[model samples]
Target: MNLPLNRRLFMVGAAAIAVSGPAFANTTHIVEMLNRHPDNKKLRNVFSPSVLKVQPGDTITFMPTDKGHNSVSIDGMMPKGASGWKGKNSKEVSVTLDLPGIYGYKCQPHYGLGMVGVIIVEGEGMGGNLDAAKDVKQRGKAKAAFVDHWDQIKAQGLLTPPAEQ
Candidate 1:
C-alpha cells in the first residue's frame, strides 16, 4: 500500500529535524596555544590567549606548535583531583568542559613561572558571572601573577610581546 503525501512529508521533515538537531546542539570552540617564545624553555605554559571563557559542552583545542607543551587541570584549582597532562609533541588535544566553574590549570614543570590559565565556564541562570564560582581567589591570583610577569616573560623570550601588555 502507498502512503499518503502528508504522511511522507511528515516523515521527511522528521528525518531532517533529527539529522540537523545534533549539529546545532553541539558547538565547539577552538582555542589554540603556541609555544612561541625562546625562553619558553623555562615554563611550558599558555602565553597567548591565556584566559578562556566558554559555555558548557564547548571544547578547547590546545595546539602546541613546539615540543614540551601540554595542558592539564590542577587539583584545588580545577575540578577535584585534577592533574596535568604530558607534553604533546606537535599535536592537538581537545578538552570538552561541562562543569560551570572557574578552572585553573598549569604545566607541570612550569607551574613555578606561573604557566597557568583559567577557564570560566558559564552556566544557565548564572548571567555569565563566572567569577562567582568557587575557587575564584586562587584562579584570580594565578591569572594576576601571569599578567604581572607578562613583561618579563616576553623579555625572556617566552612569548611574543603583543602591542600592549
Candidate 2:
C-alpha cells in the first residue's frame, strides 16, 4: 500500500507477463546429413543421431554437413493430417511439428541406400500413429534401417504396439 503508483503498475505488468508465459520452452534439435557416419566410416549416407526424440512445438533442423543430401518425410510415415517437409539437396531445412507422433524420413536420392532417420514426438497421443508408421513398406537397405530404428525405439520404451496400448 505504500508503494508509488508507477512502481505498482510495473509490478502488476511484470506479474501478468510471468503468468502468461509458456509453461515449457520448446527445444531445437540438429541433424546432420552426412556422407559418412561420424563414429563409423564404414557406414555411408547416414543421418547423424539417426533416431531423434523431441517434444511438441520443437524444431528439427537438418543441416547438409555433406553434399548430395536432403531430408524428406515419407508418405505414410507421419500422423494423419500432419504436414511433411522436403529439403533441397545441399541446403538446410527446419521444421516445427506441433503434433505428437512418430515421423519417418529419408534422403530422396539415398533412400534406397538407407539414408533414413526417425523423429519421435513425445506427449499425449504420441503413440496414436505408431503402428501405421511401423507398417509403412520399406525397400532396399531402408528395410533394415527402419527395422533397426524400430528396435531402438522399442528398447527406449517409446514405441508401443496398438494391442499393448
Candidate 3:
C-alpha cells in the first residue's frame, strides 16, 4: 500500500510506540532459612545470603529450608506506609515490597540466636528509614549480626544505588 509521507511517518511512530515495553520488570528474590550456615558449620541458625538488594516492586520470598522457623518483619524496620508481614512457622512467605527502603526480617524461632536478614529496596527514599531501623534495639547475637550487615552494606557500596541517566 502506498501512503503519503506524513501518514507513513505517523504510522511508523505509532508502531514504534506500540513496540516499546515497560521500563523495567519486577524481580523475585529468594532467601533460605537454615539451621546451620551452608558453607560454615560454625554459624548456626542463619539465612543464606543474609543481605539482599532489590529494586522497587520486587518480591521477596522467604524459603523454609529447615523446620521451626518463620519470617517476620522487624518492628520499626520497614519504610513508612509499608506494612509488616509474618509467616507461620515452617511456612514460606512471599512479600512484594513497593516502598523503597530497608526491610529487616528474622527467623522467629532463632531470632535471639541472630537468624536475621536484610532486604534493601533501591531507588528514591531508600535510605529514609535507615538510621531509624539501625537505632531500633536488638538483642542477643542479632545486635552484632545487624551491625555486620550494615558494615557490609557500606563496604560493598550498596547503600546508594546508581543514579539514572
Question: Could you say which candidate leads in lDDT?
Answer: 2
For candidate 1, what is the TM-score?
Answer: 0.56
TM-scores for every candidate against the unseen true structure: 0.56, 0.84, 0.86
User: Where in model 1 is the C-alpha error above 4 Å?
Assistant: 22-24, 37-48, 79-91, 125-165
Instruction: Name the lDDT value of residue 34 in candidate 3.
Output: 84
CA RMSD (A), model 1: 9.3
Per-residue lDDT of model 3, residues 42-150, tens digit only: 9998888899999889898888888888999999999999999999999999999988899998888898998898999988778889999999999999999999999
Better of 2 and 3 by TM-score: 3
Error of 1 at 159 (Å): 28
After superposition, which runs of candidate 3 have C-alpha atoms over 4 Å from their true positions?
A: 1-22
Residue ranges of candidate 2 with Cα displaced over 4 Å: 1-22, 160-165
Instruction: Show the colliding residue pairs in model 3.
Output: none
Model 2 lDDT tens row, 1-165: 889999999999998878776646778899999999999999999998999988889999999999999999998999877999999999999999988898999999999999999998877788788799888999999999999998999898875533533
Error of 3 at 151 (Å): 0.5
Better of 1 and 2 by lDDT: 2
For candidate 1, give the lDDT. 0.55
The superposed Cα distance between candidate 1 and the true structure at residue 78, in angstroms, equals 3.2
Ordered by TM-score, highest first, the candidates read 3, 2, 1
